[model samples]
Target: MNVSLILIILLIGALATYMVGDKFASKIALLFGLVSLGASILLLNHYNLGENIGLFTQWIAKPNISFALQADGLALAMLLLTTALTPIIIFSSFGTEVKNAKTFYALILFMAFAMAGTFLAADGLLYYIFWELALLPIYFIALVWGNGDAEERKKAVVKFFIYTLAGSLFMLIGFVYLYQKAGSLLIEDLYQLNLNGTEQIWLFAAFFLAYAIKIPIIPFHTWQASVYQKAPTVGTMLLSGIMLKMGLYSVIRWQLPIVPFAAKAHVTIMLVLGIAGVVYGSIVALKQKDLKKLLAYSSLAHVGLIAAGAYTLTTDGMSGAVLQMIAHGFVVVGLFFAAEIIFRRYDTRTIADMGGIRSQAPKFTSLFLILVLASVALPGTFNFVGEFTVLYSLSQVNMGFAIVGGTTIILGAYYMLKMFQSVMLGETNAKPFADVTANEGIVLVVIISVLFFFGLYPKPIVELIAPSIEEIVNQINRIK
Candidate 1:
């Protein structure tokens, strides 16, 4: 009857995809994506302050947990991002020869259901359940359908699985500790419970480690590049576009308010690590020859800055982090999609193997150029807006960190342009390449439009998120 119900219907439609023949699996996924998008739009239209919708509730006496679902501005934003990208990822996979197409499509839809539950779940335990639930399908999707050396792909998936699971166990420990203290697993209840400085510190540590691994912050990022490189483009898109944000979102939603004292105490350490990640990731990306590996490192650099911004505890920092999450999600998806197009055309992802493609593929070259500029945080692009705000917020904490972190702009531009020149500028090194196909063009155009539209007019997104961020910040300050 309402948007939430429609979303549930879409999830059912996705599961029903299993019954459809393999030939129509991709179409079914696309249809589910469309319906999910419509549901998101309807939800947005009906959105209001303090609005909470519950789909289910049940008592769990042992830990005082309850099964529940709720919606707010943050949840809505994440839902919108997830639904909007599913169709594009499905569309982009159209030409690929997926052997178990029906099962593949079913997994994608199930992943959507899990992701939606992650955003909507009101109970911490339920949220964690959805969080872990979201990973299995992706792991299989990557391992089974992934490209590159088969052995390497298997290793990558296993490593990714093990690393993420290890980190999540720590987070679960934090939740159990919280349940012991608060006698409830509901997020609202957790928010209301009082916590001591020492307990908060340990809890925050557990939560931060888990989220850092998911975000793939510098030192914990060994598994990401290989995973990104091996996974199919659709898998990579979903991982970067929607999954990475889970960590950043959890930082804002869980760690900050729940462990305010510890956050305040360790803010400097967080800033130091964040700045280090920013510089380190950018520098490493500069040396990457494979496009997927390059983008994977680039994502690390961007998330580093976002993590720093979130830890700043300033309104600008938190709000900018959220916007940056949305901005980077779109930009990175576009960039990866561009890489996919290039690989499809050249049958290679190595930068050295691509050259002078601009002459024969002007349209592809032009679009690639736009995406590159966006990646480097050009003034007119969404990345610029997010990065600028994040840096400004960092400046308020320590000008030195801000300056060091800000160097990412110069480094980003250098590597992105270097990549562009290597791949798109020189003489045709391979068989004459054709322009982007209609499906590819549609995906690129939509992404570009989103980048430009948001870059020019970010006020709506800012307005939607500001109040919730303010409330969270207030809660953090109150706890302090």
Candidate 2:
């Protein structure tokens, strides 16, 4: 029941890396990342499966909040995603020269720790604290080591930090209201609170603002494209890979259950908005000259559909959302790293300025093409499974809505393929191009393996999370 081990190991890993000199910082951080990933993997063994693994103790007598960490199937799936990705994230940065390497890598580990804590927390206040802690490291990562003009970077970083922090405050107020109503901050206590329809609406909005800002659904997403483009590729990976999922996971775990009536009442228009993001982000992406920003907007489109699936309140939709989060995470990171590889070689990210790479580097071209297919959710790729499941869930709800949402597949293919052709194919560039290195080859191989492995056999994940998603649906229905 000591799921806190993941947090402790990660935090200690961050500190231990700092105590060691900069010479070995990245190596040490990667070691710790692997160690944490090992622990989570061990937990997934059948022997360790059953009752929730948690550490619970009293921390504050006044507020009645406990130092609590709970891990169930849903939480464990997220923990697995975070822990598994952190190592790849660490591995992804090994070749780059990072100043103050200790600090930079430590923040990455700390970010993992905070995100893991967010997934495992059983107390409302504890969850909020971990949620906010997740923001600080990425803020620094983007501010200090991020790319682009100094003034522009500062503006984007500050705007992102302030926007998300402001959203958190509203969520905090919602938690506090639930606390007052329930007389305790335990999630179970909050779940049992007998709030009225009016109260539920307020709580739902507050919590939605927090999650939506992080997910950056639409209007609240002003900071997403800028910060993503300005941040280092690894930072962008962290943001796209695991950070955005926190908001999405919260929507399913925290918001919907606490305010089921509000969720039920407002879900139609909210879903329409989610579908709107799909159209808006795609059309915007179609016009993007910058590779990173195009990927960012494409991400907005992908997550919009996931958000819409979540609010459907159907078992199939919730299951698809969880599945899609994992799918999107791996695909997005691979895509960003592909962009980073291009930047490393060509010193540019503009799609218009690139061509004929496939002629020189067949290996890199093949990998990039695979990711492009995965992103567009080509049949037999991992994303297609989640996308199909979600679209099916939507179809069950409203065939027309599913049809609108389904256009992402078409639009996704149109833009991603155009970018792929512009950058990876066609007439030779005057500049020389090198094929994928052993390191880059290994990373891409791992990514492709993961996408296809579950792409073909997603039963393990589906079985793991299905019961929990069904429980959540039941919870939503039972709310008074």
Candidate 3:
């Protein structure tokens, strides 16, 4: 199967799910999500056998843009993340009530399609288009379906929409300039453009602005916590889980390689910004009373470290970023789902209002505790493997960078455990807090399983991403 089939499956699924109406939309979305996951698996197998599954054909002859989709190991790994999580995200919403269920489910599938395209598109313009398209579904999902006061939700969502859209325009300008110099917008062509130091610096800033805002690294992260708190749980999941990775992935795939000299020159600044986000995010997370907002800041901190690793310009750093990207996706989704679970039962997200859930729901407490431990990168969980590798890569750059970046683990454990104790421990709430239903249990089980399984046996992921990351590192260090 060609890589394009995955996109086609999701697009068709989106349309079909919408047309089938609300009653069947969720099931259909889940089915299509599973099918797409299966398709990605088949493509991965073909890719492993060294069969070409990517698509490349002429699109707009005038602009020299082609409809290209490349499925190297790195892209496929991301595609797998997108597909695997789509179903889980959908399934997580199964028992929850949703307004305009058809539109909601369809949008989720479409967002999946857009995110997959973003990962696979090899043409710079195509990738940009996919990147922006991913925003639309989430915007509507947050604005229309989100919670909180109407005006407040609007303010938050609009700020997010404007911040991301504005940042992306800078990136588009950079791509336009690159197209002028290279005579093509294909990624391979862009990489070969031997631009001077001045040009590289400009292009680097443009792309970095876009990525930093999307990755929502510190300073550029003002829009994050409010939006995360306001958006529906599913929308929050899509944003935190998959959409954030789009920016980090682009740094490796687009930014660093095309502007190697500038990237190399500015490594220290990048590392500082990344670690700053780590510290800043973690500290802010400590003060959050709202569970989702706390997790939002927590996400900011985690991605900050991931971005730091990507900026380190080493193979270990890049691979660790990718591995952590996948791990963070699952863990964050589970954590947010846990928040949703609490919100569902107690009808409150305030940490102050929650208490003593362990007495009522052992299964939920156990799973949530495990997820919390994974978030802190406990030694045996998948998060540890990624966090440790990222830290080691930082150390190779500078011990100071590693030391500051490592604060994420310690600070994360502190706030997450504190939140858990407040929400799940102490005197039992007079209101009933049920154990996780079978569906909820299944979702948490699946997430924890991936964490532990990969934690112990990360060789598969490490091996899969190594060659691709090595190529990017070579490209970054190669000077014309």
RMSD for all candidates, in order, please: 1.5, 1.1, 0.8
Among the numbered candidates, top lDDT falls to 3
The prediction achieving the highest TM-score against the true structure is 3
- Model 3: per-residue Cα lDDT over 362-392, one tens digit each: 9999999999999999998999999999999
The best-first sequence of candidates by lDDT reads: 3, 2, 1
Segments in model 2 whose C-alpha atoms lie over 4 Å from true places = 46-48
Candidate 2 per-residue C-alpha lDDT over 12-96 given as tens digits, one digit per residue, 9 for 90 to 100: 9999888897889899999999999888877766324665577889999998889988777788899999998898988888767
Candidate 1 per-residue C-alpha lDDT over 1-480 given as tens digits, one digit per residue, 9 for 90 to 100: 243574575578677788897988889889988888888877777775334445556758775678777767777787888888888888888867888999898888888788887887778998999999999999999999999889989999999999999999999999998888878888888889788878988898899889999987768888888899999998999899889888998999888988888999999999988888889889999999898999989988999999999999989999889889989999899999999888888899998998998999889889989999988888888888999999999999999989998978989889889988888887678577889999889999999999999999988888778777898899889864
Per-prediction tally of clashes: 2, 0, 0
TM-score of each model, in listed order? 0.97, 0.98, 0.99
lDDT of every predicted structure (CA atoms): 0.87, 0.91, 0.95
